[model samples]
Target: MLGLESLLFLIEVGTLIPLIKTNKIKYNVEEEGGCDDLDQGDNGWKIIHTDVFRFPPFKSLLCAVLGVGAQFLTLATAIIVMALLGMFNIHRHGAINSAAIVLYALTSCVSGYVSCSFYTQINGQRWVWNIILTSALFSAPLFLTWSVVNSVHWWSGSTQALPATTVLLLLGAWVLVGFPLTVIGGIVGKNRAGSFQAPCRTRNIARQIPPQPWYKHTFVHMAIGGFLPFSAISVELYYIFATVWGREHYTLYGILLCVFAILLSVGACISVALTYFLLSGEDYRWWWRSVLSTGSTGLFIFVYSVFYYRNRSSMSGLVQSSEFFGYSLLTALVFSLMLGSVSFWASLAFIRYIYRSLKMD
Candidate 1:
């Protein structure tokens, strides 16, 4: 599947590169007040270049989401590298969990910087609110889930519940270290930010998006975009699930690393392809669509978890099920943000590449 996707992406790049070059030539001639004999009717993507980079609706939320996604990407990569280098025993779940917690706190600045810089570029006025949103984007929901799961465990008198001191320590770490670093990063980012550098000038009024076919709709994109990346990692995911829930110990960090890379590549490729289709259809609202298209992979992950729980795992009961699904939900959320960020950035780069060479006012 990965090979096939890569082939298709290569084919797409080959086909589009010449078209982009041709469009650039014609656009340059038009700009110089010269006429080109070639018909311009086929330049669907070119026609919407003006609105392609326009800031999407809910720009603040988009910036925050992307920022958190960046943080997750950094954390995941760092952990994988450390594990591959044998810095810690992969079987030591406690050590791994502690390292992950510390790394996540340390990476808070990444989210802050990315979110604030992006918001600033889009000319956002509420810098303070943007920073707050970025800080709380992932943590808030996570805290809520943790609270519920901990309460359930505590009520059941299970040793799995975190002690009060440990919980307080985790909270203190975030409040003192994570939040401050995020604030500092946001301040720095805001100071360094500049106006958005769009290739073409946006019109005073927004352009009307043409009616798209059913296949071009957001749901269809999400289904197709999410499925491809999910398929790429589905087999590896079974082993991961077994390691986490069953008694099996997974130590294949190398294969895990390779699968992770393939997952991201497949996601990026599918997203770029979908964004191109959206642009060709004259749908300028590709911003959120790009995210959701690949982000939907998380939904598939959660669905697979349901299947695993039903068919594979023997664990049952309210407490166990609650704990399993709660953590699974968090896992799904992480993947969604991580892959969504990759998709959006890939599409953004592709859009910029194709539009940058055109001579547009």
Candidate 2:
């Protein structure tokens, strides 16, 4: 898997090199007194400079989603680092879950800071609603899933169901620790926020986006952008599934950490490449597209989970199936946010760098 990822990474980097060169050449031509007219058959990214930084619609929701993604990125890194340091027994699932819960509560401030700061930067007026949305982005869905799964377990009198007191304590932790920290962070973020600084000035009239090729469509982008990252982790995913559902034990935190890094790198590279393609087509709606493109990795993971459950595992019956699929869905959601954020940040950086280097007035 590592070898394949390394090869794929090299290929992605190779693909990006030419795009970067083309952008640089276009900028140089403009600087050298070449034609500046957009209609002169120069279909490069320079033509859409004015609209490149336009804030996408639903700015508040986008900010909240990005904020949650940042939080998950931090949480995953921290957990991996602690595991590498032998902070807890890898064989004990309960220990890991408890630690993750505590860390997530502590990390609530990160989500608040990111979401609120981004919202402010984008000129969002609904600060209160933005913060509320950020706080509930993942938690709400999780609660709903937990309720369904727990009810199933309760009806079956299974010991796997969490006790009512435990559920209350979890809620209490989020309400008291997580909520307060998020509010505090939101206050800080709002105060520290600055204006959105796009290198190119936007025009009063938005440019009409040309019809894109079939390959540049959102679904195609998702399929292409999601597949490489999913392939990078697919082999390791089986081992993880085996460890969790089967009797196997996994202690190679180091390898897992490496695969995790590769996953992020692949997601970022593919997103940047796709964003470049979209921009070359004079499409500036790259914000959500960049996210959804790579975020589709989660969809692939969920589909793989179905495959794993049907063929790879020996488990059976309603209790196990519901639990497996439910948690698998949550895992998919996490990956979507994590990789999606990485994709967005990467594309944003790429866009800014190219625009900033241009000879624009």
**Model 1: ten consecutive residues of lowest lDDT:** 32-41
Candidate 2 ranges beyond 4 A from true positions? 1-41
lDDT by residue (tens digit), candidate 1, 1-361: 4798899999999999999998787656655432233323455877776677778888889999899999999999999888888888656667778899999999999999999998999889898999999999899989999999999999999899999999999999999999998999899999998878676667666778888999999999999999999999999999989988887877889998999999999999999999999989888899999999999999999999999999999989878998999999999999999999999999989988887666443
> Which regions of candidate 1 fall more than 4 Å away from where they truly are?
1-43
Q: Give the lDDT of residue 301 in candidate 2.
A: 98
Candidate 2 per-residue lDDT, tens place, 147-207, comes to 9999999999999999999999999999999989888888899999998867667766788
The TM-scores of all predictions, comma-separated, are 0.88, 0.88
Clashes of each: 0, 0
- Could you say which candidate leads in lDDT? 2
Candidates in order have lDDT scores of 0.89, 0.90
